[model samples]
Target: MGLVNKTRITDNLAVIIGNQHIDVIATEDFPFDVQIRFIKTDDAQLDDGSGKKVFTPEYQMAFAAAYKGKSAFFSNTEDIKSFTKQLKEIKELFEFATLNKQTWFDTASFDGVLSQKVGSL
Candidate 1:
């Protein structure tokens, strides 16, 4: 199964598997290939004292970027299209964040950089 209640955080970012499952945030079309960050939001253990793992749906996000070096010539069109779609979804998430007047940076380390780039969004 796929992720449920998917939410976009930016044009190049999204929040899937949050609130109920693992907090998964993704970014695409960056300087590097598609990058995704996963966060754990829920309690690590259940209240019943059982050792069973919690359900966290896994999903894939896509993005497009130019291949460097000798790999450029071996690129596949289908893969590129899929990646572009994923990148577009991430961008939509970013737009959503801007509209909601939210900060993209969750940590103090990136606050300065995010502030400078906020104007571009």
Candidate 2:
């Protein structure tokens, strides 16, 4: 599974992960150094037959702006647009980390030769 581009419809943003839809919300202070939260829409189970619903923690991304050698804030439309650009990069990093973790586990028990082969590929 991979992170898909967020679709904007009106005032809300939708991020697709696997078959799930996650909503992104801005913090109370919108036009400033703010944090964005990713909320999962479904309560899916993480364990098989455990009956325990998967608890997806809120994922947040923050951005701070600086101007004239001091801390600046988002004050215009451009600032909000820049924040969205940063959000895209953050999502990519999140997906990369997930993929790396999976690859690490898949090769963790490999023998030395196999490990080297996989590393070189």
Query: Which candidate comes out best when scored by lDDT?
Result: 1
Misplaced by over 4 Å in model 2 are: 1-72, 104-121
Clashing pairs in 2: none
lDDT by residue (tens digit), candidate 1, 4-44: 44555555555554332323354543422323322223233
The lDDT per prediction is: 0.39, 0.35
Cα displacement (Å) at residue 40, model 1: 25
For this target, which candidate reaches the highest TM-score against the unseen true structure?
1
Regions of model 1 farther than 4 Å from truth: 1-13, 16-24, 27-74, 102-121
User: In angstroms, how far off is 60's CA in candidate 1?
Assistant: 30
Give the total clashing residue pairs for model 1.
Answer: 15
Q: What TM-score, over all chains together, does every model reach?
A: 0.32, 0.27
What is candidate 2's TM-score against the reference? Answer: 0.27
